[model samples]
Target: MTNAPLILVVEDDVQISRVLQTSLEGAGYRVAWAATLGAAIGEARSRQPDLVLLDLGLPDGDGLSLIPQLREFSVAPIVVLSARGREEDKIRALDLGADDFVAKPFSIGEVQARIRAGLRRQRQATYAEPIFRFGNLRVDLEGRSLRRNDEEIHLTPTEFKLLLTLIEHRGKAMTQRFLLNAVWGPQSLDQAQYLRVYMAQLRRKIEADPARPRYLKTETGVGYRFVPED
Candidate 1:
């Protein structure tokens, strides 16, 4: 229903957006770009691209602020591209309505993979509708958001991907190694502490009951699982 599977690349930096445009087009995707939040919103309203590559630093407003608004109007997946290196920064963006994200200075391969994942999710959403719910937690796959007790819950980039991978896999128990590799990368597989920190953080937000989680079940010496309470 979109025009050429169009993708919107929104970055205040002209060079970055241009480079992304070229890269995406070269890979056979049509792209529209905007250098400001206002312009980006306009592009979304008029063009309605299939996917969006958003940068955290926009000229008019915080890129995160625009996400919930955009989600209200479109089903297009938004993949955030940010240079912010802090764990909190990534979490904040994900908690907004972004579907996926990569820290800036990201490689082309990563971006490509991210785009593929987003499109794949878009397609999957069309056919099989899966809503993750456990206690007060709920994930709207199509809308790319989370709600706690009917109220929205915000997550960051790392947190969002972490949660998605676990919930997507559901009962299929994964390991710390698998979680690290899937969300962080192969190189971070050895950084086991990262998993601990993130898992703890996710519990605080998703657990009604962070003290003892019911849905995000952990497999000590292994990984975690998302088994919705029956």
Candidate 2:
């Protein structure tokens, strides 16, 4: 069996599907594509891809319909790639079971990064012990504790949740909307300022110097990324 992670790209547009396949393969990931929803379901079952990049607009039916069905059989992470940009649409997809969402006309670099993050999170979830260590920072998943050099680091409930979300998907650029939805809730998706405020608090508590953050790096117009130490 091939060791490279397999990604199923469910897109109807031929050219777009080609681009996605080429890009993913170029990044050393094995890819399978299906233009229709039925084909996608079949491919997914047979191949058991490591991740799925789904497009909401499918010729046979709504791609959203496949999310729950896919979930019935596989625990692989699903990242929606579609033209549906409205907040409700995104929330609906997330609620349905998608791990992440990227609207159409997205940067290839960003999508690739998100895919890597999703795969990493999926693997970590299956681990017997999901303890993460980065430099002086350590996160204990089962105990829900944070420590710096063996000393417990105090984090407010909100701050702790935000930090956990980032660390769980470390190495991926999480959009502001995604972060808000995950940390706050669907109603708080519009509250960008809340994220900024909490992120500042997190940085102050965790960083050696908040001015020069090492782990919680911002993605400028996008969102934030948790860069774990090598």
Candidate 3:
């Protein structure tokens, strides 16, 4: 299906690449595989994949290098697949702008879920939708207003700014530093506690259950991610 989203799979291992290709195709996506960093960059540039499934370990070089390269031309989400489960590794990838990370020995279902979320976010970004809705919660980006279950909810200017920042980078796992800089400015980089306070305030107004937020999720040891549902 030419209309299907193209997913570039950058993995050297034949087995993993084959599996991902098969599963992604079966999930209604156009799949392209590149076994090395060089080929991956070429494919990304030429085909302009809707999303990228990248392996951290490549034959030519570390896959981490490809993140900025691909970012230069495309906004396609990059989901890293690696055996390195260390917190540092994940922090590095997310900091580098990798959309999401999957530890090796991952299930097809999990990967597909990540892909779906990434693509959904990508679509939102592409269209620049004026309004965002998740369940009964509705955000009017143009109007700068939010509503829950037909009732208009109020958010302070700071809270609204923070929420807007998260919505702009909807699907990607945003590091605390990134959010801080985007919403508060570079000077507030060290004030992580500001995020914690505002996030809690936001959850109270947007989430049906602030205790178990469905949209604003915490990526422990990293930061937060806003998962906007359909």
Candidate 4:
């Protein structure tokens, strides 16, 4: 009936698909399944399911290639099913507007938990205006402004996005590739320099000492993270 939520499952692995379908059905969901991006898009567009279970490895297309395209129609929470499982991949998916992800060979319990989290997020549209504070620096997203010890600061669009991305996952390391892809595009996956430039610019504006940034710290070969002072 209409009381049950519909879930669109996209996976190329037949057994995985079957297992997820069975588990999801067992958990009381109306299920729709697809094995490729084309079919996934068609079903997602037409069905407008309450949520999406998207597989990264499709025989017909790359899952990353389909995300932006899918965003055109469905605002349903997309939980990426990927084998990459790297921290970078997780950050990238999250930054690209995915609600969550489950790596390959995952436990059904974990997937169900993530699904619950994502759906919970989707339902809670009204959030308390978060005022992020790290030492002397503060950002009020609802107010759309930054402050340092009561002094307001200006931020460009790109700078704001970069700052927002870092702040969203404070203390978590995010790769240059992930940042570049999220803000720039998939074409920027190879352009680490862009990330370096933006990080430097952000530090200059937000940090007390850009040369020795405390909040926006880099992880040598990996990426950057925003660390809030306790």
Find the candidate with the highest lDDT and give its number.
3
Model 1 residue 69 lDDT? Answer: 84
Error of 4 at 78 (Å): 1.1
What's the residue-level lDDT of 221 in candidate 1? 41
Number of colliding residue pairs in each model: 7, 0, 0, 0
What value does the lDDT take at residue 163 in candidate 3? 91
In order of appearance, the predictions have TM-scores of: 0.58, 0.72, 0.94, 0.58
- Residue 44 C-alpha lDDT in model 3: 94
lDDT of 3: 0.91
- Give the per-residue lDDT of model 2 (tens digit) for 64-135: 999999999998989999998887777677667787789999999989978987887777667736688888
| Poorly placed runs, candidate 1 (over 4 Å) | 1-3, 129-230
Cα error, candidate 1, residue 60 (Å): 1.4
Q: Tens digit of lDDT per residue, candidate 3, span 65-159?
A: 99999889988899999999887888889878899999999999999999999998877777897988887888899899999878999999999
Q: Evaluate model 3: give its TM-score.
A: 0.94
Sort by lDDT, best first: what order?
3, 2, 4, 1
Tell how far residue 213 is off in model 2, in angstroms.
Answer: 7.8
Query: Which pairs of residues collide in candidate 2?
Result: none
lDDT of 4 by residue, 141-174 (tens): 7776899988888898888888887766554446
User: What residue runs in model 3 are displaced by over 4 Å at the alpha carbon?
Assistant: none
Q: Clashes in model 1: which pairs?
A: 90-156, 90-157, 91-155, 91-156, 92-156, 95-154, 95-155
2 against 4, candidate with superior TM-score: 2
Candidate 2 TM-score, C-alpha based: 0.72
